[model samples]
Target: MENARRTTLADVARAAGTTVPTVSKVLGGRSDVSAGTRTRVMRVVAELGYRGRAGRAVPPDAGRPPFVDLVLSGIEGTWANRALSGVERAAADAGVEVVVSVTRPPDDAWLTRLLARRLRGAVLALVDTTPDQLATLAAARMPVVLLDPVRQPPGTVPSVGAANWAGGRAAAEHLLALGHRRLGVLAGQRTHLYSQARVDGFRSAVTQAGLDLADDRVVHTDWRRAPSRARAAELLRGADGPTAVFACSDAIALGVYDAAAELGLRIPQDLSVVGFDDLPEAEWATPALTTVHQPIAEMGGAALRMLLRLGTDQPPEAPREELATRLVVRGSTAAAP
Candidate 1:
């Protein structure tokens, strides 16, 4: 008797004249559905009390295990992996499951997929979001937290990131302290908020030392290995090239290594290299890289905890949180040749 009265996903779909997946999407808080369809499906869900009829996500037979979505642009390399490890560890400790979703180009395919389930909140890692998308999530009463937002996100969107400017400054300071005057920069996308902050920080340190980045000295790349390698080769091969290079990421620093090997320039001896992010790869490199440590894993964990707090309607006093960064000296830097 009770089973007959239960409002299943199918029941809402039938009442709304849509498929179960569409109803699931609407209930899940996805932005892919048409306005009319979302409205109709939600109306049926309200009328039938779909959530109350059964339970969130799974059936009543199994206890409701709340979960959250960890959405990313891509989970390809060490940065993403470190972030994922942190989030997963946090979720494990909290006894909640995490659903990872990836999408590129900001199409919100990950969000669409997330909406098909009953999730408590979301953490967007290195993914951009639009106002329209935020409004859709708002309509669904979903809380979102950004992990290292591409730019300064709206005040309404809470975010967790490291102290990028400080890190960049520290990297430059280290190089300057080592007596390297002429320097090159391998920066990430110039338009990125953090990227700009880092560069500005490095520039600030350089300025304090009575130096500045030359027009041809700074090369902005897409933060990939092959392209960065090519760009570094060009920068190093130039006449009167910089004796030291500040790579925005450890990945980029590796490219500098490749370029040096190809150009017959020995690290620290001929070409000093410093990198950011202090990824494990930094220590594993042949000469061990000097770098700024951004606490990438901690940022990921912090974002998850913030998202959970938002889920419980307990937001932090500050919406934007930034962790600190520090410089770790290693074998890669030396006095200018």
Candidate 2:
């Protein structure tokens, strides 16, 4: 009952002006105590951070090695799986454990639960962080590293990502080299930093080739396939639709394929397609997708390593590190018809 490290029922009893037995009885769901006394003790137990018999039975940090949270915006597709694998592998090598969670940004429920636990740090993948959230983590001294954050994070936070702009330019240059003057772009959410970076790079390349985005097609849509398909199909319906299209993600590229199929357009022959991320499924497509290879797993590992350094009171090698991205040529694109 004498817990020096944390609050105990004895401490709760003194604070609540009651006896330890009564506090214990209330926690145990016993009905012997008067309602008024039980209510006050229960409130004090919550305030004092005293858990019942289960919590007091063992030390909170005892026998449990430190772990980091691998928080994902959502486990949407292969990207999340690959990111998780990379972090898990790196954590395993570093003698740390990974606790994965799917959470939404600006939500305090996850923050409250996270703050209550004993975690080394957290790696947020494709998640947005608010000023308040960053302040809370800073106040709690919980280290964090952003992995391809949806938006640009504050300069103070460390972040890891692939070279999105270069990847976009590479995709654009590839299409342009293949004799395609008219190009199209299927971008993710308009506010997504990576998405916009890719689009900007793509435009820069096309402009360097004496083409203008004003004459090209650019559709900003959801990162998933269904919405992309609808948008791409509509764009393709135009008489001057692009001969080649650059999709910001592999998922969106697949949707373009669906659109092409719906419209009876042949890959590379009728319409050339290029995608980003170069996910596993890209190779198995009807005509293997020519895409930009973003080191998704490597980014996760980098974030994990950065978080570990921060947890150890060491500064990261850099505030933001972007791994190189390269274009992978395949069957999806060809010289314009």
The per-model lDDT (C-alpha) reads 0.81, 0.82
Regions of candidate 2 where Cα sits further than 4 Å from its true position = 1-63, 312-318
Q: For candidate 1, lDDT tens digit of each residue in 302-337?
A: 998888777423233438899999999999999989
Considering only N, C-alpha and C atoms within 3 Å, which residue pairs clash in candidate 1? Answer: 28-115
- How does model 1 fare in lDDT? 0.81
Supply the TM-score for candidate 2: 0.80
Predicted structure with the largest lDDT when compared to the true one: 2
Residue by residue across 58-128, what tens digits does model 2's lDDT show?
Answer: 12376677889998889978999999999999999998999988786544345545655578888989877
- Which regions of candidate 1 fall more than 4 Å away from where they truly are? 1-62, 311-318
